[model samples]
Target: MKGKILELLKKNKGDFVSGQKISEELNVSRTAIWKYMNQLKDEGYEIESVSRKGYRLILTPDVLTYDEIKDLLKTKRIGRDILYFNSIDSTNSKAKQLASDGKGEGTVIISEEQTKGRGRLGRNWVSPKGKGVWMSIIIRPDIQPIDASKITQVTAAAVSKSILELGIKNYIKWPNDIIINNKKVCGILTEMSGELNKINYIVIGIGINVNLDENEIPNDIKDIATSLKIESGKKVSRKQLVANIFNNFEELYEELLNKNEITHSIEICKENSAVLGKEIRVIFRNKEIRGKAVDLTDEGELLIENQEGKIQKIISGEVSIRGVNGYV
Candidate 1:
């Protein structure tokens, strides 16, 4: 009922909609509409109520509630069922639990803040209260466990394209991280629970620094992390960003699932790659190899050329671009 009221107000945004009209449209009492309007105001929505002009939606808060994002969403299934939380230990952990309980695919677990947020390599991800995007998605694909890593690439492409849609220049730091201005603004962690031949479910955790200011960023990662607000010089709408991500993700994921090919996603990754044609250091299993990132394979693997002119295909590793960020 409240969502319907919000929808009416949003449709007539910046204009007045009479209480009587709303009551007739939604079949609710005028007194109930008044109460709902008050509730929306308490939830941080700025609505103007005139003596005879009724209500006008002045501003929408930067919130991630389902009511806030439902209207913004344009995807078929990626975010249709969202489990939102004010604060949680971790969206990934909660999503994994739900998936183990036989939750359907495309169920999203999102939180305004994650008390125990973590990134790739188990590094602590700073998810300040109402400051960033901390969410996880549960998926049940029929592919083998070995093919699970491709989901990371697909997510990277989706995130890269979504951020690009916001007029922000960003790049995909192969396998999972999204970089802006040589600093990381987002990270993806893909975890799967299944046997060698059969797969049960996969949880893809995505953390993005959206509206955090300088003070909100931890001191340890200030040099290597940034937020969209810090880069764009404006506050970004988290709901819109979330919708864009789901829309792009659904498109790319459908391609991967239905057609069994991610050529479009691969093209997006290649076009926005941060390490292609650059000298890099690949660290895996306590071994470091120096190579030049030459190309990305059709299967989304990194192709590296060693100093000896030998090409090697890298599936997963910590790739650090030499001379950038002092990582070498």
Candidate 2:
């Protein structure tokens, strides 16, 4: 109801909308309209309410409000049902709970800040208030569990493509990281719950350093992590970035499902690849293998030739790939 009222007020921007007219249009009583208007004001919407003139939306806050995002959404399924939070433990945790509760595919859980945010390998991710994009997408693809790893690559491709569209030339560090100017700007973590033959659900958690200042980053990771604000020297609209990601992700995901392959996504990763053709060190359990990243196989595996000159295809392991020369 509040969303509807807000929409109406926004549509009638720069002009006063009478309470009686609002009540008539929404089939609500005048008192209900007044209550909704009050709620909007509390949410930081500068609404002017003159006794006879009704309500006029003077300004809207730059928050990632549901109504604001939904108004700009262009996807068919992804983000159709968005669960937004001002603060949370983690978007992935909330998304997993929603998936268990039978939330449909493409349902997104986004938070302004994550108190217990995490990255791949259970490493802590610093997610301060309004500093970056912390969100997870729940998907129920009909692919086998063996193919689940592909989703991570798909997410990397989607995010990298979105960054490129924003005029930043970025590259993909095989598996989950997106690098810009040798610094990591984005990370993706893909988690799933399913059987060997069927995937019940997969949650793709994406964290992008968007508007954080250099001082906001932790001292330990200050040298390796960067934000779009720092790189582009401007503030970015999280709402627009989120909407663009959903649009790009939905397009690629639908293509994968319909054709049983993600050729386009794979091609994007290869083209913007930071690991391919670079010397790398693959850190697995108890051992580190130095190799040169040759290419990404059709199945999205990293093909690397070890020091012994034997090319190996990596599907899954404790494999933490790092550029031998620098952090890519």
Candidate 3:
């Protein structure tokens, strides 16, 4: 009911709709409409109420609620069904649980803050309240479990394109990380539950440092971590970025599902690659191999030419660029 009222007011933005008209259209009493309007105001919406003319939506708060982002979204599937949260243990955890319960594809789980946020390899991710994009997407792709790593590349491409569209220069660091000004801005973690021949579900978790300031970043990672606001010198619209990611992701993912290929996504990753043509250290298991990142395979594997003049296809590993951001 509140969402309907908000939609009506947003549709008639810059103009007033009579309370009586709203009551008739929504089949709710005028008193109920008044109550909802008060609730909107309390939620940081600047609504103007006139004596004869009714309510006018003046401004909307910077929030990532379903009602806030629904109108901003342009995707057909990726974010059509969103589970929004003010606080959660982890969006990825929730998404995995929901997917195991037979949730369909393209369901998004978003949260304002993650109490137990994590990154790859069980590393803790700092997710301050209202500071970043902490979301996970549940997808059921008809592909083998071996190809699940490609989803991380797809998501990295989508995120790179979306952030570039916002006029911020960024680069994809191999399979998952998005770098801005040579610092980490976004990270993608793809988790899958499936058999050898089939994939039951894949949860793509994305955590972006969107609005955090220098002081907000943890001191341990402050030198290597940054936010979109820090790089862009202005506040970024989290809702718009979320919508853009979904829009780009849906387009790229459909191509993969329908054609069983990720040529376009791989191209994007290559074009905006941070490690390509640079020396890198591939840390796999307990050993580290130094090589020059030369290219990305069609299946999204990292191609590195070792010093011994042999090229190795790296499926998954922690890659540290030799000279970038002191990552080595």
Local accuracy by lDDT, each model: 0.91, 0.86, 0.92
RMSD of each: 2.4, 2.1, 1.9
The candidate, 1 or 3, that scores higher on TM-score is 3
CA deviation > 4 Å runs, candidate 1: 12-23, 29-42, 47-58
Better of 2 and 3 by lDDT: 3
Model 2 / residue 252 / CA error / Å: 0.9
Decreasing TM-score order of the candidates: 3, 2, 1
Candidate 3 C-alpha lDDT tens digits along 110-217: 998999999998989999988899999999998999989989989999999999988899999887899987789999989999988999999999999999999999
Candidate 1 per-residue C-alpha lDDT over 214-302 given as tens digits, one digit per residue, 9 for 90 to 100: 88888888889999999999988888889999999999999989988889999999999999999999898898878999999887999
Error of 2 at 85 (Å): 0.8
- Alpha-carbon error at 1 in model 1, in Å? 2.3
Candidate no. 2 TM-score: 0.93
- Runs in model 2 deviating more than 4 A are 316-328
